[model samples]
Target chain A: MSEGPGAKVYVFDAYGTLFDVHSAVARHRETIGPSADRLSELWRTKQLEYSWVRSLAGRYRDFWSLTEDALDFAAAKIGGIAPEARATLLDAYRALDAYPEIREVLGELKAQGASIAILSNGSPAMLDAGVSAAGIGDLLDDVLSVDELEVFKTDPRTYALVTRRFGVTAEDVSFQSSNRWDIAGAKAFGFRCAWINRAGAPDEYAELTPDRTLCDLRGLLDASE
Target chain B: MSEGPGAKVYVFDAYGTLFDVHSAVARHRETIGPSADRLSELWRTKQLEYSWVRSLAGRYRDFWSLTEDALDFAAAKIGGIAPEARATLLDAYRALDAYPEIREVLGELKAQGASIAILSNGSPAMLDAGVSAAGIGDLLDDVLSVDELEVFKTDPRTYALVTRRFGVTAEDVSFQSSNRWDIAGAKAFGFRCAWINRAGAPDEYAELTPDRTLCDLRGLLDASE
Candidate 1:
């Protein structure tokens, strides 16, 4: 099949979609024991929930602080993590490794002339750390953080950063996220979305569909095609 | 206990705090089959997630529509609910059973000279149906729907409705919810909060604590005492 008109800008959600958020907890599995996965799940749940809650309340806390807060809540449930272990896990978060396919996918998008970027709730410092740590900082054209607006993702204003910075309409932007809610929100905000369902989870949001569904970044190129 | 200086207004969260949200699915457990609990869990999760997502995006659909949309999403995950069964479930939702303690607590609060009201993301119609069905309409001084603001709760503006309607500061309003997020939001917005932890779940939001933690409405009286 012929390649359709390519997107002007391709925006990727940073945390679970690109960087493996669970990696931090997984790296310390020996210390965390069997509850590693459960703790990771709860930590992620609280992290996102806090972002939404803070956004709704119009009280913005940077993602780094929010992540720490989520970890505190999750640690409490699992009978707590040692301070040294907690420090190690949090340090690992700032340098979360990208999924195996991320670099190649970004290369392809760049070769195809799509201006690739990240729009995340991560603070500028955290995003910088992740991008540099993953060695992909040179590949991205821009990094947008909701910290500028003191809000979190799924907020239309947060998504508008892409349009303003890239000089493209929402439709001209192709946004990808592993999050069903993020996909729905981006679709509702008029972006051409590619939902990266890495976990093969059932679709749990109605009325809105991403323009594309990819099992991984490898499928992103095909979806764009 | 001398009522300890009764609050100017007692604002309750409608869905899980006052009405049992799972009652609709529970009523038709046979129809929902083995997935009854799972379906109910997903429905409630999606319902709240949609409200927060919509509010963040500034695209507000009434909670009634959001509820149906959430059900659609939930049913899809559970392999879909038939139209007739779906109708039955939705209809049942309109008249959810109030928690056994709700009426008695409202009566006690009223007798103590505290203004009792509901502040929910529910559309006025849904609140009306539940209130009327439960025969507690007369006990409530006012029903505040976030529909007027076209936003969901946790948005400080939604909580501001209490102050606007009752001519009271947030400190004078005692807000209660079974949802931890609601309690945290209310606390952050400056309301004296009572978190009805009916399920005894761990408090996931950090730093913000409810003024009272009650197993049920019976404890509300004691908390005041």
Candidate 2:
């Protein structure tokens, strides 16, 4: 086994990081017509918005429920979706396509004696289905969900789950996320953070900076060396 | 003086509820081209998103800074904005137009011997600017902001400011907001919430229902009687 980097555990965020959140809507692009992309964008945006709103309101709803609520809102905004189509989209979400590099990257990290896991806002069942469908289940050491704590990400308690689960301090883990806000939260919580900027999004959260800003997960392997 | 309803205090949310948040972009519509409406929508969406994210992360930046950051994000998305135009937009935000009915509604409520105050996510300075610009400063009994607590709205503590300031319970105050999420939060916190559904948007936060859903601020006067 290759020597691991300073980080004993590499915790990844699931949606957008490993799984393509838009893949579900993309699969239904034919039926959704020209508004498919807009629908997907709105769906994801509202999904995260609801999570943060509920988290701040101290009202905990599972990610799946939030996902449904967001989908409904998106559908309404895009002029209504059929109930059957909505169901199909939600089903597609459970088995979203994993980013092409995810399997190979996770394999490389696992072979290097690194403990890989997912810390996501997805419900436990949702994460399980995603991992199983993506066929990355065996490669991960653990799959942690916010459902365990009854709060969403960016919450310190949500990040603390990693430390508690691995019996490691925040510094011992490298938290990776595709979201700038997630990276900001992880860095603020004292975790070594790697921001996967696949879309080259503009910088935000002026006060916090990630340990590494990578184009994709393949860079995680290079960071180890 | 008109007799009050079950609620003792009329607590208004300054942005959107009283002030026209989109008026800033509407003012710059000619310069912004056809993307003006999109930019305004994005700016407002990101502004609230940043607040919720920051609040969940337990990192509090004042609302003005968040507003600027949000505007920058919106500008970037709409294919870059001129620094001068960006400045103009930000300046416009400080003195956003108050809704047409605000003066009359607040006056009607205040004249009826109801305690009228603002409970908003805006910073004290921002709220002061908005209230002053709207020329309704004399009608308010008090203006409360999350800046004092260093957290944004939807936080129980943020909502608690109303109770503590007025020496009243949640049920004794009628909290009003144009944002459905804000209404959900205020209602969840046990306040008598009036959702100012100006756009007649679809319902959200399925579990919590507001005490009143009004098309405009004029309805507040009717609800009081």
Candidate 3:
């Protein structure tokens, strides 16, 4: 809550925050069995871990490649996953389901004349496919990716994309994400931030506190008030 | 394996590579019950996670504060920890036991005219305390901490401390760590890298492979030969 106020533009992270990344694994519960939930957790954990590590190391790889690499690690950890099932899961990731309340929340903000866009670690193609699948691409004014900068979110450079795109200072933009790390990153980069703590998880980043924290994106629009 | 060969100076990560981070919990196993091992694993995981997130977010808390913060997270997850036991664990961490072969391996490297140093995320006080307690403080020519740069390892600035201290290029240093993420960072920073796979863990960094992968520090002295 260190920042001054809300912002003119509203930027958000794509995966997990807007889209249900685990929905891909949930769709194949029949073949995956009891380990399905664990697989999903492992996949998502490795995905973010790889991104952070890669970003810190200055070794840039496309998000899709990292996605496949994470899947391989998860599959190996949760016992051997069949190639066919793996392929299906990978395909499903390209079109992850949007969270139930995203459209309503985005629509409310847009009506208030706030600029809306996705600033994500997702590549151009991945973010495009996700927005298209969710049928909410039209709701967003822009879809920005870190691929242009050859880095990932949490890097100040990646957060700079939002300001660079619309010619706004970080204070003029409110960044939102379900990931605690992303919220910390945005807040540290000088943006007003809202942490969507979907699961009511405890805050892990002890140093950086978000401007606002809510149980869902539904609270985000109300926070601007 | 991307580098040409071994390096002039041998730099290492302190926590898991040279010191047994789990020794704190191992000392309290009787009190901790079956959850002792799980607590250790969770503590170590959260400790590293907090450091990475904090570094990427640019919040810059020292490693000691991050360690205590991570311990709080681990304690909350594993029900709760008693204050007396917590005090004991924290004290044990200051003097965590070094690996059995550390002295022998370090001696062999020192005999061959290698420059020995530790470049760790630990604070100056923490690294000095650990090194003194382990009785090998004299074996190292330098003890570098990220506190100088106010950042964590894997940040190129932290790595630059080694080069700046020795007036050598990254190619002149061979960095070793039990943490795969650390290895990726050193390698990406252009140092010849050695991954001490102490636990036989799978390689998580799919993008950059280490120049040398050893079961322990035993293979390292010979690898340079």
Candidate 4:
């Protein structure tokens, strides 16, 4: 059975799902130089790796720290990423260019009376920087961070924080996360999550499949009606 | 103080360290046909992803089951891979043709009379498949699995299990794990670890630098003796 329409709150996962971190790097490819794509891939791989390892070791550091550290590691290996590029690159994350159709999709959803929020794993400062840079603040109701929870998205407490902040029943909230793991966690926690298959990948965990899977927010909101 | 050369057992992680499972698809490129690289990459990526995701979510499935499931998931998206090809692709993993220099290196280590063992995250059944196929059962002193501990490696208990089984103190052993996190966890548990930098990659976690880092087993065993 489909989750009822009362789940009107559209919570978007900020990275990869809404903001194309890849595009952010692509825009600065000239500055990132020959290792641009490699740098981006390495940074992304490192970014995720740090989170899981740190979490496992019970060594907690916020996402921004992890992101910058990962970039620095990638930079040292492939020379020519200037200090200025760091600011521009780091600054670019907050203002990351949305997928070409994102704004329009959000507009359509809001027009139909849905609340959109950014519930990201990004640190507060980092999330603010990206959301402001991309001009997504106007469309989002709240930019929730996992910083306070001292945990990452899959942790039950991480999603519970969002539920408490929004005052919505877990199942009545339309949680969207780009990561299959996040989607799995939300589904397991009773949230009506929409897995944004941006990479066109399937969730491997059969026990925790999302209620709905979509290509993007457009499909998510459109499906509700 | 250096770890004395007295009774220093080298517990080598079997899968990525000595064996390369990537060939599971690469060798069967003919059967994989088109999109061979992509299919192989997805299979490998999903296998690792499933391990980490399943580990974090407190959902435990043996590496064997997860490996097959990941292949099935990837195959489904890659033009519906034939069952026969899937079987052949997996058969390659049975032996995982060791790296070109692995056998000679193992021979050299044996020549030096170093204590050798296979410590892996694979269950007993899975470990037996790979070990017997490669005919390395005679080369290794003891084949250790996380099964006895009922926990995967990178867990402190996993490292302890190996050390405890060998009846040697953690310092009396040099742990070898190609995985950055595995090295980190092994080091955290106070095992002197030699990270095989097979990828020549930078350290994933800056905090967990190995006691000894080397290009491969030859360098590791040679440097110690």
TM-score for all models, in order of appearance? 0.88, 0.96, 0.90, 0.84
User: Whole-model lDDT for model 2 versus the true structure?
Assistant: 0.90
Cand. 3 TM to true fold: 0.90
> For residues A28-87, what per-residue lDDT tens digits would candidate 4 score against the true structure?
998877899989987886787666666655566899888888888788778648889988
- Give one digit per residue, the lDDT tens place, for model 3 in A1-225: 122234368898989899988999999999998999989988998887788777776788989989999999888888868889999999999999899999999999888878899998898998888999999977898999999988787889889888888888888988889988888888889999899888777777766789889888999866554
Candidate 3 — what's its lDDT?
0.85
Model 3 lDDT per residue over B34-107, tens place = 78887898788778776777667677788888788877777777877887878888888989999988898888
Best by DockQ: 2
Q: Regarding lDDT, does 1 or 2 come out ahead?
A: 2
Ranking the candidates on TM-score from highest down gives 2, 3, 1, 4
Interface RMSD for all numbered candidates: 2.1, 1.0, 1.7, 2.8
lDDT of candidate 3 at residue B105, scale 0 to 100: 84
Top of the candidates by lDDT: 2
Candidates' C-alpha lDDT: 0.88, 0.90, 0.85, 0.76
DockQ of each candidate, alpha-carbon based: 0.56, 0.74, 0.49, 0.29
User: What lDDT tens digits, residue by residue, belong to model 2 across residues B1-225?
Assistant: 233454369999989989999999999899999999999999999899889888888899999999999999888888888889989999899999999999999898887778999999998899999999999999998999999888887899989998888788888888889999999899889999899999888888888888889999999877543
Pairs in clash, predicted candidate 2:
none
Number of the candidate with higher TM-score, 1 or 2: 2
Q: Interface root mean square deviation for model 1, in Å?
A: 2.1
For TM-score, the strongest prediction is 2
Q: lDDT per residue, candidate 2, A1-225, as tens digits?
A: 232345478899999999999999999999898999999999999999889989988898999999999999999988998789999999999999999999999998888778999999999899999999999988999899989788898899999998888888898888999999899889889999999999988877878889899999999988763
